[model samples]
Target chain A: MNQFNIDIEHTGDYAVIRSDGYINNLGGEKISEECCRLLESGCRNFILNLEKSPIVNSIGVSILIELIERVLESDGKLVFTNLTSTIAKTFRIMGLLQYAGAFPDELTALDEIKKM
Target chain B: MTVQEIKEIMLTVPMIPDMELAVTKTVESLSRFIPFTGDQVDEVKHAIIEACMNAFEHSRSADCRILLVFKVGPCKLTVEIVDHGKGFDPALVEDPKIENKLFKNVRKRGWGLKLMKHLMDEVDIVSNRNGTVVRMVKYADAYRKEALNESV
Candidate 1:
């Protein structure tokens, strides 16, 4: 099993966390840590691109929910871009849409965040 | 004859060996009926592995065997994962959507179940009466359309 890869890229005002591989318990923790590190660096806007990632378990999902809460608490917004349909549905059922928003592609998510 | 021709298949494996690969291939083979795409297949496989691993670790059986039965129908595919252990309560499990991070550790066992429910069309479990039987169903429509475009 390959641990998920997280790449942090900053474009002026927004930061993107591009993840690849299975998002299980370990992957979830890694993602959470990365998000926290970015927040500490004064980068609040986030766009998670899960296009290369195929499967994400509940652990990953919970970590995402935590990220969403943390972002909201700091008046920052988190958007998920390029979600696989299964993940999109999972986010929906988990009611993540109530707090976080999703876009079909990364560019759109970035645009949405800029507008906010 | 293809995987679609088969009705049911039973697999019993010792919990000591990590059964993730076996369950992944088995479920992928049955994708003919469920019509899951490569990505959907991966999601389902991960969920099953998590469920089985939980049984292998937390369940009270020292040397227990896990039984996975698959039933393939014309319109749906169903899987029953059974373990002879102390069993758990499905109703008591909290929703993973809640922001309470405190509950994550306590309900770590049910994480697989939650993903299974989210990935599959239906998920039902019977616990305590005769151990735990996790039932997962995937509709043909979910896979058939995708199958037409991709090789299963």
Candidate 2:
């Protein structure tokens, strides 16, 4: 199986993490670590693009919840862009949508984050 | 139709996190033989992964193994995930949505069992000191109804 990976890009005042592959334990941990590293570097706003990741288990969702908490603790916002319908529904059921917002695309997410 | 074509795939892997991808992919591949819609396939994939994760989390020993059995029938798909772990009562898991509101920071631990039950048409769990087996089923008739509703 191919291991999951993330590519980070810093744009203006925010950072974006483009994740690929299944977001399980390995992938989730990597994403969390990357987000924390960015957070430490004074990057408060983040947009996570999960377009390449089609599968995510509960463990992965937990990792995302932790990231959301971390971002909120820093008084920043985390948004998800390009979510599959399945993942969108999963997030709704898991109550992540209540705290974090999801946009249709990266540009829309960036637009919303910039306004915040 | 004559006798229903039945296909089976059995896998035993160590209780680890990364193995979930392979297990879910195998389930996805086996489900292709059935007449499930795209959404149905996703639901089955999610449910199996949840079951396997539960097994990984609750297994007794570090070297414990998880068993996944996929049984495909003409009209139904059945998955059984077995684990040699100390089992807990499923009744103890409160509804995540309700819990989400009561707790300040929403929890991530309790959503797996609820999701498995919601996604699959049928679910059965049997656990004891020996091991745990989670059986999940999805029927083609449900998809037929969905197709009918979509066309209507």
Candidate closest to the true structure, highest TM-score = 2
Task: Go through the candidates in order and give each one's DockQ.
Answer: 0.22, 0.53
Candidate 2 clash pair list: none
Interface RMSD values for the candidates, listed in order?
A: 4.4, 2.6
Q: List clashing residue pairs in candidate 1.
A: B35-B143
lDDT of 2 at B136: 87
Can you tell me which runs of candidate 1 are displaced by over 4 Å?
A: B1-5, B12-22, B33-50, B53-60, B95-115, B142-152
True contacts kept of each: 0.27, 0.51
Model 1: per-residue lDDT, tens digit, B63-131? 488889888876567788888888888888775545444224433224555667767766788889457
Native contacts recovered by model 2 = 0.51
Residue A94 of model 2, lDDT score? 84
Candidate 1 displacement at residue A34 in angstroms: 1.4
lDDT of 2 at B21: 69
- For DockQ, the strongest prediction is 2
Q: Best by lDDT, which number?
A: 2
lDDT per residue for candidate 1 within A24-74, as digits (tens), equals 667777878988888887888889888887666666676777777777777
